[model samples]
Target: MAIALTTLVAEAQRYLNADSISDYCPNGLQVEGRPNVQRLVTGVTASQALIDAAIEAEADVILVHHGYFWKGEDPCVTGMKQRRLKALLANDISVLAYHLPLDVHPDVGNNVQLAAQLGITVEGPLNPDNPRTVGLVGSLDEPQSARDFARRVHQVLGREPLLVEGQQMIRRIGWCTGGGQGYIDEAVAAGVDLYLTGEASEQTFHSAQENGISFIAAGHHATERYGVQALGEYLAKRFAIEHIFIDCANPI
Candidate 1:
């Protein structure tokens, strides 16, 4: 049974609350494709390779984490940007993107998903006052060693996490699933024993050591894969729409 593109877009927008957040790409339907979508493809980024793959698969719509037209990005579509859009538009493939909303969505968010894998039960948002904070604070079911936690992160994310273990138990944890090293201060202020994020800057090492908080740098793309997968599963169950997750390998 094929679902109408309009219906899918409407449901996705409502589910993600796309209209409420200030995001890079326009939340829903970046490019219009067939009115009915039988097959949907999802990926981390709407890059040239992903678009080409979607086209080859005859995907009616493509969903991604990083779409076109970010806040500080080069607006002039010249090089890679131009090529990405060209492929999608040429193939008449609809592009739907969710950024912060995808990251912060309680049930299907990146942080929440990553925490779930780490055996942490979420207590609440990292910043309780800030409704838009895309990080979670939680406690491990039982206090595990910092080394054990780091190993678990590696097992789940398929990469050895860059880690700085503080002299503390691994009970209280804070996590942000993408490039969120900037949120170290918030996690520290919240009094969490450990903080985990995707990418680590050089300054993060200093912050982890000086702040006396354990830090783990799981790969950015690796940590993020779960949210969209959960979202795709949700869409499949709710709408009976066929979904496929396309992984474009990104080390960073």
Candidate 2:
């Protein structure tokens, strides 16, 4: 069944409460394409490879977690930007990006989805003071060794997570999906058994070791892959549109 692009974007924005949160990129309709959309493609990032695959799949719209036009990026449309924009304009495929909103949404959210996949029970936010806290603290069904928890992350995420072992056993854990290593401080302050995130900074190891909190740096792409896919499935079910998820893996 075909769905109007406006209706789809509106429903997504409403579900995510996209307008309430400040985001790096525009939440809905980053680039306008055809008015009616039947085939929708979703991905973690709207990179050129994903765009090409969507074009191959004959998608009318491309929805993703990471979209274009960040706070401090080159404003000019040239080089890679030129090629990407040109492809989208020529093909008439819309781009809808939801950054913080997708991460924070209680349902089809990266943190919650990751929790479900990793078998973590939701407890509360990592930073209770912050109203817009995207990071979360939770408990495992049963306590496992630091090594075993890392193994679990690897098994669930399909990639070997970089483990910074600190404590012997892990129960209380804090996590945010992509590039959220900065939140480790909050987790450390909260005295969680371990902290997990997509990317690790240079000082993340030091923080883990010194604070006696184990840490895991799962791949950013791997950690964030679930939200958009879940959103796609929800939209497909809600609107009766054909949804395709294209994975263009990034090692970093």
Candidate 3:
């Protein structure tokens, strides 16, 4: 069976509470396509490769965590942007994307999903005072060495994360998926024994070392792969439509 494009977008926006959340890009439908959608394609980003893959898969809609028209990006659609939009427009494939809404959601958020993958029992947000905080503080069932916890992270993410070991064992943990290294200080203030995020800057190493809190920088793509998939599964099951998650791998 097929679902109307409007219905799918509306349901997704409602499910993720996209309207209330302010974000860099528009949350709900970025591009409109055919009136009805039978097959949905989901991915981490709406790159040209993912768009091509969706086209090959004959998808009626493409859902992603990253979509077009960012806050500071150039408004002109000239080269790469033109090509991507052309392909989607030519094939009648709608593009729906959510950013911060997908990261902070209590159920299918990237942070929550990553915690489930790593066997961490969630305690609360990294910053209690900030209701919009994307990072979360949690605890392992038992204490483990920083190295051992890094091993678990590597195993679950299928990539060797950059680890900055601290003085203590990893009991309390903090994490935010996809380019959340900026929140390291917030995690530190939360008093987590370890902090994990998608990417790290040079100063992040010093923060981990001087503050004596373990830090891990898993790949941005690796850490964020789950939420869109979970959201896709939820939508597919809800609307009784076919859904396929396409992972256009990024080494970084």
Candidate 4:
């Protein structure tokens, strides 16, 4: 069954509550396409590979967690940007994106999905004072050594995580998906035994070591894979539309 493109976008916005979040890019309908959508493609990022896959699948809409037009980025539609837009326009496929909203959604959010993958029993937000913190603080159902936890992360995310060992056992921990190393400060403030995020910085290592909190830099694409898939499944169920999650591999 095909649903109007605008209707689909509105439904996504409602489900994600995209309007409430302060995001770097537009939250919905980044590129308009055909009036109706049947097959939908969901992915971590709207890269050329994903777009090509969408075209191959004959998808009318591409839903993603990372889209273009980021804040402070050069807005000129040239080179790579021109190519991506050209393909979308040429094929009449809409690209819809939600960044923070997708990360923070309690049900299908990136952090919560990662929590399930890592076997975490979430206690609350990583930022205690903020009710809507993007990162989460939680506990393992059973505590394990930092090394073992890294193994677990590898098992779940299909990528070996970079481990900065801290406590012998990790019970309570903090995590955010996709280049969220900056939130290590918040994790430290929350007094968790460890912090896990994608893509660690040089200073993150120093801070984690000094503060006695273990750190894990799981692959950015790996940790962020779930939210888009979860949201895609939900949309598929909700609208009776076909949704396929295209995993375009990214190492950082």
Candidate 5:
């Protein structure tokens, strides 16, 4: 049976727990597509390629991490913006986006799921004040060499992580999925032996070497793939609708 756009929007809202704050982009139903959606396509970024793929697949709705109307994006709907939205709007495909909420959701969150897969037991959020903080602090159940731990991360994530080993062993570690190298200081203050994140800044090498904390840069797209995929599967099981994850290979 096909699912109504309204029902799918509500389902995503409940799944992400996004009722508390003013989100930057329209959280659910950014662009109205078909009235009923039999297939829901999920992806990290709603790039033109993804939108075209979804349209070709006859997806009635698109779910993504990065949607339109980001904070710093231009307000004027022109160029690529107009093209992307026009395609979805023209086809009546609903767009549902979950950014930080998906990153922090306990069970299906990117950080939490990545930590669990890497054999790390998460203690709590790295940033206490912000509910949307994407970083988490955790401890490895059994301490291992930094190289061995990195290997395990590679095996679980299917990508070789760029690591800067520090002076200490890796019993405790902090991690944030998706280009969160800024949280290294938070990890250091939390007294974790290592910090793992997607993408690294030029200064990150200095930070790890000087701050006496190990740092690893796992691929951003690689690390963030888990949460949305898990969420998609959950949505499929919970609702009688089609859900497909479209992977856009991103090396950065």
Candidate 6:
């Protein structure tokens, strides 16, 4: 029912191929805790709410997609950072996080998981030339109007995405899970009928409009919910330990 914290971390690092992928933050074991883990908590982000929820749940380890110590962030552990680290240290709950590794994993990656949810049959990477590209190109089972595809996105993600309708029906589609509107140009180059991502920038509209490709900006949190859950389930099954996914909802 329980596994060593080191063992769990090693398994996760191996399973996700964490070390091979480059990321903004460290890939695994952001916070050290007890030697053994019986209950594992997983979430999209390691926010204060999630930490509190994990403490209440009596979790021994917290695995997440987003964790602390990002590049360019202030090195000083003050304010919100201090509080988050304090709670984790006090409770002896380990934190393991994966950013790009979770995004690009072929089996449990965010992009692949989103495609499965939206009924998109993945054809290939959004950018074949770039090994680091996290977006993907796929196709709907049938060609649907931009509005119809947007409706499907809303239904699946439980949030109404911002839609910029294009002139054509949505068949060949491209998407990246979080803050990937920057990849719209790559999607356009791939010849997708529509492009979807979590957050859109101002220039994204111009790119979509000029290129005649529909665009959808689903909430970043909503779009990325699945990968961590999938990874949690996989870990629980693999280690025969308890795993709980806590969603501390973020609108953005």
lDDT of 5 at 187: 80
How high is the lDDT of residue 61 in model 6? 92
- Superposition-based RMSD of candidate 6 using all C-alpha atoms, in angstroms: 0.6
- Model 1, residue 8: what's the lDDT? 88
Give the top-scoring candidate (lDDT): 3
TM-score of each candidate?
A: 0.95, 0.98, 0.99, 0.98, 0.93, 0.99
* Tens-digit per-residue lDDT, 1-252, candidate 5: 887778878887887887754666666657777788789899988989889999899898888877878888889989999999888888877788887788888998888888878888989989787665579998987888888888988898888999998867889998999989988887888888999999999999998899998889988888888888888888877887788999887787
What lDDT tens digits, residue by residue, belong to model 6 across residues 66-159?
A: 8999999999989999999999999999999999999988888999999999999999999999877789999998999999999999998989
Error in Å for residue 221 of model 5: 1.2
lDDT of 2 by residue, 1-252 (tens): 898999999999899998888877778889999999999999999899999999999999999999999998999999999999999999999999999999988889999999999999999889999866679999988999999999988888889999999856999999999999998888888879999999999999999998888999999999999999999999999999999999898987
User: TM-score of predicted model 3?
Assistant: 0.99
In model 3, how large is the Cα lDDT of residue 128? 90
Q: Model 5 lDDT vs. the true structure?
A: 0.84
Model 4 per-residue lDDT tens digits across residues 157-209: 88889999986589999999998999999999998999999998999999999
Over 4 Å off in model 4, which ranges?
131-133
| Superposed Cα RMSD, model 5 | 1.7
lDDT string for model 1 (1-252, tens) is 788899888998899888998865677777787788888898888878888888889998898877776778777978887887778778788888888888998888877887788778999989998776679898987887789999998887789989998998889998898898988999998999999999999999999899998999998899998888888788777888788999988888
Cα misplacement distance, residue 134 of candidate 2 (Å): 1.8
Please list all clashing residue pairs in model 3, or write none if there are none.
none
